[model samples]
Target chain A: MKYRFNTSTMSEWKIAVLFLGYVLATILAPTTAAENILNEESARSASEQQKLGAYLTRAGNCMGCHTAQGGQPFAGGRRLSTSFGIFVTPNITPDKEAGIGSWSEEDFWQALHQGKSRDGRLLYPAFPYTEYTKVTRQDANAIFAYLQSLPAVSQINPPSDIRFPYNFRPLLSIWRALYFKQGIYTPDQSKSAEWNRGAYLVQGLGHCNACHTNRNLLGASEEDTLTGGRIMGVNWYAPSLISRLEVSSGDWTIEEITELLATGISKRAVASGPMATIIRQSLQHLSIEDIRAMAVYLKSIAENNNDDTSGTLVPVISENMKEQFAQGRKLYDTYCQECHGVSGEGVAGIYPPLAGNRSVIMASPLNTIRTVLNGGFPATTAANPRPYGMPPFQQILRDGEIALVVSFIRNAWGNSGSWVTALEVDRSKSGER
Target chain B: MMHFILLITFLLITPVANAAKSVPDTIAERVKACTICHDNEDKIERHAYYPRIAGKPQDYLFNQLRHFRDGRRHYQPMAILLENMSDKYMLEIAGYFSTLPLSFPPPEQVSIQPDEIKLAKQLIHSGYPARDIPACSACHGDTLMGIAPSIPGLLGLSRAYITAQFGSWRNGGSMRGQVSTCMSEIAKKLTDDEVNAVTKWLAAQPVSTQPGSISVLSPALTNRCSNIVLGEHTK
Candidate 1:
């Protein structure tokens, strides 16, 4: 009777314990699972914010100006030479002592929207705050978060070396009053959302007019126009975005314009020098839709400003220039014909065709002069990696020869650019604007 | 041409007077001190320690100047001299030196074991494939005159200079962080005795009648070296 009681009791005790454990687990699971879900949602939202901020930062090309050559990214000491004076960019890293780590999101928004520092100091126009003023508060907040997320770098920013009258910080107030306007971009209700998005990016974050428009002596832009101008300090010129005589994309397909913006090269054109830098650092990183939007906006502007008078003014070849023209053709055959072709038509896409290229026929001729003398690669991007290069002729060609060759190509193939003088070439050679 | 003759006449008329006071302000005048050590004299003894740089490829000369300027090469005097030079100025100096007509002394007669000569020839011509070594002629042309743009000729170099270069490459002194991995790798692979034999043989060889570097590179050898790009466009 005692043995039968021992086996039954053992089995019943084990079942009772197992059922109790299952009941406890069922009761406790929901609280922990709900807590996990809350944590995950917050984490994912923060990560999404960081990701968008990073993308916008590239779109703005903050690193291009903020980072000095061979210096840590965003720990800025870049010396930007302008007509006013040299403006050294400030550090934007998250170091507590040396950077903007102590800044609140509101303080950062004030800097972008109002061009005022946390301490109420007026920032220079060289920082391009005039363009940043149009950035949405939400986007500005995202950029701040992204910058804060960066590895903190302890680097002290150097004071800008602005010349006499321009160095006076109060003078910037008058300049800002005359030139700058602080406002967020308002979408045009009449236009398509795509067009409105393009306008916001180009006018706000893209800052296309900062380089494309001519600046007055006070360093103020003419207007929110994409007409061409010479970039201060750098002898290279930024060609017009609207004029067909310079870099109009009016006739180009949207896909073609997008390809050029995204890849730095299209069948009809290639970006070199400053534009090349922009494509490499900023435009190349944007989504195809955003780039297409930019193209659409630029093309619309170009169409409105496009004049049929482009390429109609043929320069008369003077008696003195005839010999130069002959010499240039000979030189072109010997050196440039292999890649640029016998008729001055460059290999399509690989080597930009010189025949109808707007860059070659631009009025200033600085771009063509610089390109031949210095030689350059079109922007190296993911879509167009291993781009072809032009060998620098500075060593091989003299000032006269460069002038002649530049003049030859500009006039050859139905182009109407004026002949460049040897003196002009000489000036360019010495890097004197 | 007339101005050159006039300069010669002026020099001949007052040799001592012109020599002290009338050196023309030109790249040739600026680099006169370099020629004192890197002598290009035709009848000088062939055993000089300094390697002749005249008539080398322009890009090869330019790269050397940059290496010295950037402290990639260990030589202090060269680095000091080239420290402040710009790329445009360096190209000008390189062009001046590269355009000079080439002249060479007869190859020095070296006394070495026949077996050493055979090994050197094998290494230079065919290379030891077991060690994944490429032939010297792969990048440097079959004539050892180098392929144009950046490669340098092997012939007419002093034995001391060649030995020093090999040692430099082996120790990673000259090509510090440079992309030309083949030379350093080759230097590390070769035994000291093999390097000695190779240098002796190379130094004993006569300079080719056709001077400077050849522009054409063999398609097979283009990818063997890291720095050189095949079919690179140039003037």
Candidate 2:
């Protein structure tokens, strides 16, 4: 008694109608902040508060920025170089003189919420208080408690090396007035609790927007959401999370996205470079439910489309390009074909397939070039303890050779990315920001 | 219109002058200072002071850099230059130097007595077995070119440089191998005359036509020197 009359088409129609209803519901929901709830979160048991603090610290990736190269954890001296200035991270250890030991819970809240230091000096935005301003008072106190629990280490924060006009602190007020907004995440009534939790973490503590959004001339983020752009000074592109043309996970299963968030490698994709650091230090520590929630939110935001991986469009190759292409094929066979297959289908779970990989076919060939030059090492999480590493080719391949091989992969197996040039490779090698 | 766009692009992309002026930031440009001493041209009349770093095995070169940085092998300027470098930076420098392909000039025919040549060859090829000394070929490949990754080649070095190294090893000077200081022990065992003879013969021998270090390492050598592992004992 099965009544099958184009069930797949019917399902698609149903999904579209449901999606439209959800969109309309979201538009009609009134936006409001419950400021009273912020104080209510603080009255937890001391031990429970400590545990939560530690977990939230991992969620926020506090140690990744604060700790210097080969220095003690949170005894901050890490340097971040940007076009605006070179900002040195401050010590957050509980040392009386050098760290945040003297700061009360109220003082900590003022710093996180108001972007002001204990002495009432306007703190630099480099500290990411712009994002931290959205963090709840309870979460801030928990992080503070965790810092208070750590053994004190005395290391004075180095002053940032900013250029003349930026070095003037008072000027930040103007920038803040124009771009900044102060508020905690107010949950949308239309969305589920899971979606709201995901929004809070991603928008506030995770600060995904920092690298994933483009910046304007004054170094303010151009968009509030993750329509990705090139991370200045680092040279890696954080591809858009919402676009079907880019790194959207809308088509991916809930399990696949959750696995990638939890372990840094899923069946479909593997995280590398800056994302690898985040996975190792932050995402891997989070609970499975929270990771799934983030995935759910991300998937919901992804724009719909027919599969970008399927159709094969023939590319125009010039006589000069043909010769270059031949040379690239030879290089690929010699070096890459052993791991990534002859047709660019890499081993599942171990070596990610280049075929249909969004990262490979990305408009900017920066990440592909970088992975080849610096080696692709996914984070060593509990799930994938001994992740197979891609050896760096910088020593073996010259700028031209790297360009050719990278361009070959991008264009092979129905992937239609732009050809990488030797000049771009040279620029990247010279550490061009 | 296209030309105007290109001009704007160039202006926007250019780094601030202060950033560009600070240091020779690229690994390739930064390593230019090394050529001032190493002078890795493979000349017939070689500089006797600095060893040619150009075509040395990468791990061998890497270990030497670490030794200099960590104070195991002391040269004040070398130490200062490498003091703040991370292991990864040192590896990059090593890799950069190791891949520079250069043709070795024929070895300079240093005048030596036939007796001295015989003694030197015996010590290098079949070391004094009674004194528990292994052949140079046991670790450095049969061609006297290095084994891939770690062990350094003994050929194409100046006689003076070779002699100085032996002296440093014997006298408990700055040079110290991390594994066991097996070199220091071997240096102590060899007589000054034996070292002198060995250096003269080594200097006289032709550099291997081989482009890079040989791939295989002998098992006997590995048992003798824990420091010279088969491949990349990076730590």
Candidate 3:
């Protein structure tokens, strides 16, 4: 028998074994490929439930919507307004039938991903699943697990009052097909792994573009617009995040940028309004890597570094600004000196030198005028306080005179800015006393 | 001339005193202790540690003054000055203080930790590329100080506040969590080492004196580290 064995036989045997290995691998890979799969029995455990709870906290945007009117801290019920319709919030207290007492993890993930009710009906976009679609299957399952663990609420969500075309639920499939790109983010290999990871989290899981970037009529993102956009109802413009530098000028450094994300107060900016809510809650609590990913993605964007000088087409100024430098020079000499100093250095730290203040010479002249009109006080903290401030000239000078003093401010102390015209003063439309 | 006079008349009668109303009637009566260190023309000394605060927001000033009065704030004569004052007087002092101007300081040699600079740049320009975090400048402004009064400035602040607050937020020490909770989410995500690095970078950067012209921030903030240059996609 050994004499009968040939070289060809051995080669054939090797090939057969190779084929068998490939077959086994193909069969096993799919089952493993599916991410976030959980055994029903194992998921019922408590530790898993808590982990799922964290996932839900991120996915449900639970805190953002559940918050009550007066900072009652996620007590539920904030009005959600949309172009398609208005959805009154339904309380999700842990009551028996009203909430998800009867819901299974299968049911919850379906509700989120498919936008279907437990009974199998479509949900509206007011729930923000358009952004939530990127959550992985396992994540969705975990979130479901967490929600099921919560005490079921008896509060039934009031039906959304969507007008006309929005009232139809089946129409969503087409919209989803057109606008929703569903699937887990595959890391792009060409870029740095971290950059790719950032892209995934931001474009996929985090869906930062939903708020930070601009959107078109169908709510589709305007591809060209990155971080600059207009947030409706909030009465604010979410400024551009393109430049690696600070767009608002206070010369913010990178560390300050990170601190702002984590603590809401950087040297140049303080978190307030809606963004404050986000910092105090969702974004600030993310894992460190996630924050880093976001920072990388944002900084990567190219900024419109050139100054937008269009706002000054009509350089509005005041009569007082014109007159003060021309006439009030004596007034300035008398009262302003001892404090402001002859050189306009104005006791550094005690008093901010007026020569180069942003409120004085930035492209947007509104702040400088308003600060003078309204008068301002700098914030002090555990770090430093007892800061210096400026006097309001709103009363002593005429608009022209105010204009002159402002002109002096714009011109003097090494300050070189567009001249303050009387037109600028009249344009302020002040809310000051 | 008649229109000019009319505008002046309206302004004079517009009750300008109300604008700086938070200030006391007399400088002697408000922030008398502040002058002790701040009044010096040197632009250095004890005042040097403190950033210039003139023309800052009234709300910002008021908040700090209250912090001083309540002993929530640390640092110099401010706490001592605010110690015995009533909230009203404290607010007045804040108002009075806020009216002053900021001047360019003589440059200080800042110490930059190599790792801190690396992490700070990573966090600022792009977040941890591997994680899903967004850049801090996304909403905070690229410079980290915001735009206008609407956006705050980061140029002249103490780095200690920047670092401490970040740590507190990461562990959930803020005024409780809210949806717009920017810092906490980001902080909680940062590694302890990364946090230290960011703090070092922030503290190391030179503070700019030019008020509105933050044109220099871009160059100063972009940290060039070797690991980041590898260009591998974040997994």
Query: Which candidate tops TM-score?
Result: 1
Off by over 4 Å in 1: A1-32, A304-307, A310-314, A430-433, B1-235
Question: Model 1, DockQ value?
Answer: 0.02
- Candidate 1 vs 3: which has more TM-score: 1
lDDT of each: 0.76, 0.76, 0.52
**lDDT minimum window of 10 residues, candidate 1 chain B:** B226-235
For each of the candidates, the C-alpha root-mean-square deviation to the true structure, in angstroms, is: 19.8, 16.9, 24.1
TM-score of each: 0.65, 0.64, 0.44
**lDDT of each residue in A1-433, candidate 1, tens digit only:** 1111356877798678656655665677857755665587678878888898999999899998898643689999878898778888889999989889999999999898999999999988887889999899888988998999999999998888999988889988998889998898887788776777788899988888788889899988767798989887667888888887788888888988999999988867788777887887799989888898888888888854545685465567678788888888888887677667777665446667788888898889888887777665566587865455565566456788888888889888777788888888867654322
**Runs in model 3 with CA error above 4 Å?**
A1-49, A55-61, A70-75, A90-96, A114-122, A168-174, A223-225, A243-254, A302-433, B1-235
lDDT string for model 2 (B19-136, tens) is 2443234555445436545665534332445678878878888888877755677564464344434566678778988887744545757999998988898988899889988788
> DockQ, per-model, please?
0.02, 0.03, 0.02
lDDT of 3 at A39: 44
- In model 2, which runs have C-alpha deviations exceeding 4 angstroms? A1-44, A307-315, B1-235
Docking level for model 1: incorrect
* Model 2's TM-score against the true structure: 0.64
In model 1, state the lDDT of residue A57: 95
